[model samples]
Target: MNSETTYLTDLAAVLWPCGGLLGPGDRGMRRRVRRDRGNQYLPVPSAHNPRVILPAYNRSAATRGITSFAQGHSLRERARTLLLTGAFATGMAPLLLRDRLYVGAGPGIEHALTAALDRDLSIAIHVGPPRANRKPVLLLLTPGGRTIGYAKVAVNDLTSRLVRAETRALRHLAGTPLRDVTVPRLLYEGEWNGHPLLVQEALPVGEQTDRPTRRQLLRCVTQITAVAGVRELRLSTSPYRHSLEERIVALGARPEAAPLRAALRRLPDVRVPFGAWHGDLTRWNIASTARRAFVWDWERLCLDAPAGFDALHYDLNECVQAGVHPGVHQWLDSGSRLLRDPLMSGTGLRPHTVSTVMALYLIDLATRYLHDRQAESGGRLAAVDDWLLPALEGLQERAAHEAAGPA
Candidate 1:
């Protein structure tokens, strides 16, 4: 054996006086000993450290010498060394094994969740397995046994404060019509493991399918616009009105930012009436059953936003993923028609104005997506410069042309 191995064996012998034969089972005994001494020992692989034979011989020697040490300080020191060495070995072993490791949350998860939901008069039940980022979801069974889906937001030490602020924003919005407007109903709320938990009504099964309908998308956009507008009345704080120019600037696109900013500056300040709105309206977040449409995942809902922002986001998302359904086009056309009509146009805002806003929004989204993709595909930003510049100019030209026409 090498000197290091010989030294380790000698130390094991000193720790384990009653040396017979060390085998696989002895590792567990060593682990127990380490734990008893307030040390942690991660599990090791079986190939290099075979589960059946090698550990037994090592443990036999370790136990022999270890029992001879009656001094508390000595035992503690020895235990600490063994634990540290074992941990190092285990860490290095993974380099050789290359197997994926899945570490589960310890037992405290159940207690934390149960305690938080105890006062709701609902029976808290575990739903799915724990997900990434320490976020585990639970289903709250009401007194009537109705299941409500609740998400446990995972906030690590780094993001705890930010998450708390976000949770406050979410709770405030939950009180408004916009809260459940596009998502499942929020029944109860609390915090667990430094993360927030929100119990909401379960969306109907199969409501979300692979394909989303056109009317559904349009209705979602309308709802989001209405709800977002409602923010103007309830609270002064708004999360929806971010400057596109500032956002693009932070993304390091000064060249593209110039023209886009100028184009935005030229557009008429057309205001469309808004109401309660879902700030994030994507196809995956919305579902529809035969009789009712349901939107879920309200983490991004905001009280105030442009009327066309939701439509723009949805259309752009669809375009990036692939082509959208024909139904979506029909829906947009219908919305355009409604906006053009004079009788229904004067409600809160002008429909024609919103349509124009939506068109411009779509163009901006398409340009950004194309630009980002071009960069990601190992091509220089300047390579796509030819195509992207014209696209932006065309977008501005089209928007100007549409805006000048009769409402």
Candidate 2:
């Protein structure tokens, strides 16, 4: 027994830098593990460490991976050492989850989330940005592997202010009808290390099927954005107009861009059916269950927006990302049609003004993210340019044709 103990200590000296990959007795055991996992990481849980997900076991190899690190590491490096070594003490997968990969918080966020757990039972925290709110969300789990809530870690003073709004918005919605739609409930809100943290209800989501139809989408928009006694106004420039203008400025002045920009600037300000707008409305932020859409992510929620804008924003963003083909005209047509349909919506829009409102709104929605794409270079920018510019030209041509009065 003494010899076995001594062997572990000596092995630790040699292998600690190479991602310990073992506990005291796990050297031989880990050696017997499959060597073909490549650089994939497993989220192993450790009672000794508070953090939910730890590096399970990394096989040292010639290729650069998690195992390749310098010696004489800092406090963080040492913690990582403990995580990798202490993690696999039993030579078994993390009991918390059956899946090999853990989709929870990364280091910066996990550190805060672990400290926030403040419990004795082992907690499993995974970074599920898609599940959290669609962009870098952290989730909490029970020792028995049940998801309790999500952690909303404040990224910065400026962004954290907006992050706090999510909880507030959910709290507001808690009392509302939501028609038949559902949204996440905020369980708690607290601060850690001067950063705000939110624990949100982690509701079950259904499997992804077909995209929500126009009728289904409008139903969702109406239910989620409904507010009583709000004055109806035609919001011509849209709640997103300023943001759209900002994004356009970022794109700089190009000749082809000039026409669309001019058209946008000339858009007549008109009253719209004003109401609540889920600014981040998208398929990723919505789930369909029991013939109704379940919406999440209230970070971008606001009280001021034209009716039909929410519906158009949701569908237009979908169309932009999906690159709806055959001239990208169908995307515009469908969104406009839904916006005008009184059956699917309570928002009243003028028949003569619908096309103009829709043209400007779709233009803004489609091109809003182009500046970022252009900066990234060789991303989907080319496709956006291809689809949007031609579509814009088509709108201009069609407008002129109508003005000419059927030849």
Candidate 3:
């Protein structure tokens, strides 16, 4: 079995120790597993069919689970969802065609789930693309097929930290007045079979529309930043910079250390506004509604981050995903300009030089990649040597050349 198969098998053992996963024609028939709803589970996107695993108990319930699981974020997402919906509608789901990845759930999951929520429900697990932050995300559905809430199971130390952080963030933001952004309500924060589990009330996400305007995006960022009031400070003395320095020091002999140190020395001390950021603000993590922008995934939320970080992150990630790798020049030129009008015009705040914020963002990002040991876990951006380090070095060279004018 491959890594994915291994992960699924291990997870199955935790969820159903007595009633384990089974393949086609496999013997040793544990009779008890067949009776306790163990036959209700299905493994998805396996050798039989590379599709999201949805609950296959009934057509209506399966359809609802599929639609909820696959939010129409892009054309590809929508197409896949439609195809799967059709498959379920016709009773031709891949699991029905073959028994390649069949799972049996014993009373363990139901007992823990019911004890946690005080209600019995069915579950559909979606393991997203393999990345450093990936974890098993569960959609809690009623017996009739309505998605009631969502749960995340942290399978490792990194994921466990993230799960706990999100819980804390939601609790902090709870009852806090957010103008146009809605955060998920924390329903339960506890452990499930030695793994940290977080259950949250699901947000009412709608179909995709045109991307939110720059004004709208910035407005949302502004509100998120104000959750903890923005502060003005020079980059040299700010807590944010201090934290980055500490991370570099902790990294010690890591290959990224020297380049990061050189880059830090390049930044000029300037006063800029610092505030909170959603940390992983991207297209996939946010949804649009007629009234407000619904954002989730608060595992990386930080209060002392630089202003304009979210806007930069949102735009930069879009560029990166489109195969347009941006270096320091793009960050200083268009990126800094992108923040000025949308973020500065009416707030009575000092205009942030896009370069300072951009440089700080780059450094902070590199620091996080190293701190989280993402490269070891196969994170796509973990190889900072290819993009981030070069950008930082370019920034350092430019700063040095500019300081020695008329050479």
Candidate 4:
């Protein structure tokens, strides 16, 4: 079976241990037993539809599921949401859909969810491409189609760590006052079948298709950075730098990490402002409404990092999503622009500090990729050496050339 199919099978076993998957026309079982025990789901569009597993015969649930799943910032993703919405609105969803999964026996996730929320709840599962961070993201919906919360279930070690980290990050930021950005409120966190589960309040993501403006983005970043307050520390002596070194050493001479170590060694130990960053601040992870930007995916949130890191990350990722591969030049440009922003003045980021922070960011990112085995896990950034290391090495070369004095 393909990886997706395997994942589905494994997930089914976890969610419904006593349940058996049945085809659409399986008729050997007692009608009452099937009615009371099984939950029917139609794999929308096709059997292998990787987008959503819609609860059968529930238009409201399907619509919410489609809207939530297709909230990507990419044009292709937006087109998909439109297509699926159109298909369901025209009453053609059932006709075009196939390969229904009749999970024989409930009292699994549903039981736990109902007990936790103190109400009956149904779920629409979002299935995306397989990757290092891939996990079951269930949209908890009421029988009447209201989305109550979004639950993430960690099926492996990496995801387990992420699930716990997100929970802690949410709790940490709860006490901080934020005006420009809103984060998910931690609704519940518990364990099921030995796997960590985190449920957070659903953002009022209804019909929001806008992106955050530059001013708004800067405001949000500034607020998050101020959460932990800022500190000025040299790269060589900062706790952040020490943590990175420990991580690199843990990798222990892995060929993929050699360049990362070299880059770290070459970076000047200039003192710069360090603060918190919303680690994965990207267009897709945020929803912009008129009032504020709603950002999610907080597993990577770090309390100590160079100021303006989030803005720099957002710019580079935006380029990558737009089909422009960022290199050393892009890094330098972004870092420089961030230093010029008046909002960053409090963070003490200066023009001379750009290259140091730039190198630090690259090293930080490279070590993460290697440590997470992102490439091995089928992540889009599979070849860190091809894209990331080249940038780091190039920046090293540039720094060397600049230091040696005008040719």
Error of 3 at 266 (Å): 1.9
Tens-digit per-residue lDDT, 1-407, candidate 3:
66776766666676656645646523333244455445544555463332344555566666776777675767997897788788888878844534444455545665677789998687777776666777877888888777788888888888999999999999988957698998999999998878888899988875554356777788888888888888878778899888878888888898888878777877766667788899998887877655688888899989888788888888777666545455334555556566767465433233435555676788888888888878777776677887887676665555444434431
The model with the greatest TM-score is 4
- In candidate 3, stretches whose alpha carbon ends up further than 4 angstroms from where it belongs are 25-37, 47-51, 71-74, 94-105, 208-210, 324-334, 345-352, 396-407
- TM agreement with the true structure for every prediction: 0.50, 0.60, 0.88, 0.91
Q: Per-residue CA lDDT of candidate 1, range 1-407, in tens?
A: 44323322332232223232222334454465445442111123322221111111223222222221111234665675465345333544223322111112232333444565554323221111111121223344443444445444444442244334445545655554542233455555666544555556666644143334655555545655554333222111223223444555554654666665566556554444544445446665666654445666555454444454565565545543432344344445544554444432323445436544554454445344443443443332223344434544554554566657775
lDDT of 2 at 255: 47
Give model 3's TM-score versus the native structure: 0.88
Question: How large an RMSD does model 1 have?
Answer: 16.8
Top candidate, metric lDDT: 4
Ranking by TM-score: 4, 3, 2, 1
- Residue pairs with backbone atoms closer than 3 Å in model 4 (clashes): none
Model 4 vs. true fold: TM: 0.91
The better candidate by lDDT, 1 or 3, is: 3
Collision count of model 1: 30
Q: Which ten residues in a row have the lowest lDDT in candidate 1?
A: 49-58
Better of 1 and 4 by lDDT: 4
Question: Model 4 over residues 146-251: C-alpha lDDT tens digits?
Answer: 8899998888899999999999999987877587788899999998778998899888765664777777778788888888999988778899988888899899
Give the Å error, residue 187, model 2.
2.1
